[model samples]
Target chain A: MHAVRNIRLCTKDCLCLYVCPTGATDTETGQIDASKCLSGCRACVDACPSHAISLIPAEFPPQQEKTVSVKNALLTLAASKMDQEEIASKLAETTGNPVLRQLAEALGKSNRLMAEDMLRESGYMLPQSRTVGELLESLLSEKQPADFPEAAVKRLLELVNGNTMQEGKASAFEKIDY
Target chain B: MMRKFVCGICGFVYDESLGYPEGGIAPGLKWEDLPEDWICPLCGATKVEFKEQETVIPEEKKQSSLDEEHQEKIRELSFKELSALCSNLSKGCEKQYRNEEADLFRQLAEYYDSKSSAAFEAQISDLAALIEADLSSGYENANRRAAAVSDRGALRALTWGEKVTRILSSLLSRYEKQGETLLANTNVYVCEICGFVYIGDEAPEICPVCKVPNLKIAQIQRG
Candidate 1:
């Protein structure tokens, strides 16, 4: 494990610079150099006042398995949420009243959040999971809207699949059904 | 009568009435009058990346959230729903590791759960079928509808949510197909903002969904 810094959360206390033995923590860039970082050492992790620094493992465990029942339940919940989102979206569009629109937006957001929770529980939230790569690929195959953030999604797929597995191994995961 | 144009990339709106004064374009200049080379100040997206949009300034709309229908809807929430909501709230708190508050919400959930006589019924089975019909198709429909409406924020939310959710679904499928061997030596990191998961030894410098910097993504250390 190596210590990493959250630049946004960093208060610039510079305690990590003092606590780090290998000079891995840099205040100027607000980044911790992983190469110099000593494995299992948590000097910066403990010293940071803002709780910005954390240790990340060099290896990760496989995703926990989900039962078929649980998976179906989550999908069902997500489907209902999408329905609610549709209703809220219509209300937001048709309403001449701003207050109603705002309420509709809030309702839509809450439903989306709940749906996300259920989906997360059902094993869809993790970026590292191969299932995520498949999802991105599928989206790419479909014709996106003019304003769709295609580049960001593509960049995300690279970041998700780029670091791990060699080119050949990674390609094996891309099973395009559509 | 001034028009608004939004960046296809970052959703930054360029108004004809306020023509990017900071970028040397003066007020009263129409978007057509601007140079072809001009780009979005926020994300540097090119001129071709902008699309015409309707004005949606909220303050210009009427104030107050006290709609009678909304009140009626809130009143209609049942004990079971309340229990589930409280339980979800408790889980959200727990994810942040806020133990005391999580306990409070969990206690509230139990209180509501106790008042509700029957347990929540198991409503679904056959995960594959639901994923295809509900999640996959459902997302496409929502995305299409949201796009047609042309609400930038709503469209972005749906887009991001669908992308992230699809990723999760793919990962789940992989886990189901390959099992533990797929995770033999990789490390997983999760974006705290948008919940994008990373399987590498280090997290990405920026989150794909919310575009938050690396500092917001944390490693998931399983004990």
Candidate 2:
């Protein structure tokens, strides 16, 4: 997930802190846990006063099907080392703790696994009401979930169609990882 | 006529006209109006816990909402009644952003003018009670929520604590406006494949260093 904070502009009014469900965005630190950020529930994107935050993508081609079933998706997630070190360094610099640095390293080892988990449980992929094609097209390889869960997709249609579901507490990464 | 009284504790508005109490409106009511179990939906405080909204009886009455003679008597209300009225005035004062504490007191005293004795005392004791309930209940709720969300053991392991750093970085960064560079005293990092700002010393392992296959070492200076 593309979780990064544009710290240079944030005001520290804590509007984001107050609003974030997972406390992913801390009022005091202005850093968001890249790992904990919801797959596409960009709550901080709008709550940010300075507009200093944006989510980026992990893999390039996203080689698996846009909506790969749980199993294949898991394979791709295991492949990349990604920028785990740079992100770890930044986090370590901010936290001044080696535990998170070590944790980040371990997560890097499992980034693909976590990503697959995020994708599998991602509401976009759940298909409670939608088709595979509809779900696949909605994944934002680009920055915006803009036109996300394409209108053609049934499951994508469900947030508008389904009963207002309580947003689940943990995302896929939060679920199994715990 | 019905008035909407907003709760100081929960901001829940009681629109007396809305049949919250099936029977009808009663001023200074403790009757069958508000449901006995109608706790604050947000925090669950009972109806008995709430008092009717405070009325800030005007100080030097010129226009009479009441008959001329009655208005005079209201103005001449004893010190105790007057103090109780002032306490309500303070509660009824509109809460605003950036308002000073002294201004609230000023607004409170603005009621009941020279004819009213400054020595007036109505126990205003109810004021203490309302405040006590709010503090006791409010702080306790906050504590419970804080505990529910507290990260312990491995749950703490997965967290990024990125929010804390982001806040400190913003606080530390000297910028004139959002997204605009002030001194540009920041670090530069490149996506090896994509060229996104690494914003730090070394290149990110993945092409979130998006420009290069593997990152190249580079330094950025303000132009």
Candidate 3:
């Protein structure tokens, strides 16, 4: 495992800089030098005040399996959440009252949140899960709504099937290897 | 000619025009006409339980919907409530991967906690019970009021909130059954767009729900 900084949470406490024995933490770039960071050493993890830094395993465990019943239940919940989100967005767009519009926006955002949770629980949101590819394929086959995020999904499918690691930023294991 | 009298103990209003049908009392029966043996159906209080109630006009029902006693109950914000609100805001920020904002909110929560003057520390389960009650009836009341005034935005928010809460409640029950096993070995990733949580070695190329790009997704580093 190696420590990574969530830049958003790093409040510039600079405790990580002082505590890192290898001087791996760079405040300028806000990226930890994985090569210099000792695996399993959590000095900065404990010292940081904002708790923005955490350990990520060099190798991730495989995806967990779900039952058929759980999958069905999740899909049903997702469908309803989607419908609610759409309705909320429409209401927000048409409403003239500022408070009402904000309320509608919050509702739409919350519905999306719940729907995502359901999808994650059902094994559709994980890149390593085989169900992801299958779901993408099915979505491609179906007649989706005009606003459906087809292009993004297609790009994601390509990335998932090809290089799981992102460019410019290598996996933690790869960075530590060098 | 009929008036309503509420049970002080249970908030069960006894309307003379619509007498407790299920309780075997017929419509148009005056409170004085009913036998003294008739008790509060909800709390089994005696007829004397009606002493605190006044003659409530039907049309002005909305004005008295939240009585003085209830208003007083919510008048002051307890330390626990503030802490809970800050904690909730922190969690919301965490979901959006706004780690800095989340940390700030968490600090606020801790500040509230340090200043908490309650005789006892609040239990999370007790908070859960309050949330359950709110999900069950609070949104419904708000929706009814919004519908009355034809407020489309408020109505939409209430409708979505109620439906999502119900769905989440069911999902939570299922999670309670085997959440540990379900989350045994996988890493959890959350999409910044729709707040979709992904469990894997890494985030999905795209959020299945919101279809946001990989750059927008981030792993949850629990604090």
Candidate 4:
């Protein structure tokens, strides 16, 4: 779903290359192949800053295999970046040592870099929006339990691993994974 | 040597070395050399938006955009705007990843934990919390803090704080845009029969393109 960076305005940053998980964007072609892209993943879209990239949804029949790596990458990037930022700020507030503060800042910068890479490599296309727009939209559209209910997660795990439940309390419809 | 002009609206740069062939859409092309039918190589801004890659200094015109003294109308940041934010974030993050030398930043960290490893973990966690707040906390939440900002123009103009906030907004749903500023999330419907997309909320009984009645709404899905 990722679009190509504007060569004229790219600044040759290579952030997109680092963020990409599948290496789908590593070629000299500099453009993504639609067929290799995971269905509905929008990682690279969220990473581009030049507004050069976009995600075009596959029309007609939707693809069966949903490639979730992009989503996974975003979640990890967001979580890690957010973590480093919080840690850095806290250390800055409480610690007196300038060294600790500097380390925190470094961590923060790394998270930001990873997030950017994810956005550049993320390849989802939404109309009138860049790749990042599509990725963020997907984040909202996709649902998670308790945003992370242990039981819900377990059930999903069960589904994925072919585990059978105790057959009580929750109905089959409840088994429907978000 | 090449002369270039950057498009503020779209991050497109026009390089005179490539010389658009009388072409407006494609940069680095001569307006005269291009084929008559050749379209823009980028976003297809058409020929009109291209301004001269000027050598003269038009201080007033140039400063207007960068200085931005006048408050922007603050049109609701649309899903379209999200693209710009995310792409910018990509560039920013990429810059971070490539940073090998831990200069002033690493020097600031406290490495005296049980070990350097633990110290790194603790530090990362704290940073994560700060970013989480930026991404998750609403404008109203910021308002409660007495430092919260609601105006898009003011927020957009921020140097450091708003950069994170804007990035946070990029992660948020477009539906989160509340108040009158919201873009109505509007889209025009186009009739396949005549190929007219209605630009407004209500579908007119007659088609704008073919005057056809009860025209089927064009399935124009917004990204």
Candidate 2 lDDT, B145-213, residue by residue in tens = 222334131111111111111211222221212233422444443221111223333444443211234
DockQ of each: 0.02, 0.01, 0.03, 0.05
Which sections of candidate 3 miss by over 4 Å?
A: A8-13, A97-99, A133-178, B1-223
Top candidate, metric TM-score: 3
C-alpha RMSD (angstroms) for model 1:
22.2
Candidate 4, A16-122: lDDT as tens digits: 66777776656776566655665555566667666555554222111112123223323333344434444554565556654444333433443343333332222
Instruction: Calculate each model's fnat, 2 decimals.
Output: 0.01, 0.00, 0.03, 0.08
First chain TM-score for all predictions: 0.71, 0.32, 0.66, 0.32
Q: Pick the candidate with the highest lDDT.
A: 1
Tens-digit lDDT string for candidate 2 (A32-73)? 776567766667777777887666433111112221222222
Docking class of 1: incorrect
Rank by TM-score (best first): 3, 1, 4, 2
Task: For candidate 4, write residues B158-216 as lDDT tens digits.
Answer: 21232333332222222133321222444334443322223345555654323556534
In angstroms and one decimal each, the interface RMSD of every candidate reads 18.9, 27.7, 19.5, 21.9
Where is model 4 more than 4 Å wrong at Cα?
A1-66, A124-178, B1-223
Worst 10 residues of 1 chain B by lDDT: B119-128
lDDT of 3 by residue, B60-105 (tens): 3243243432333212223433344445445644644445655655
Better of 2 and 3 by lDDT: 3
Docking class of 3: incorrect
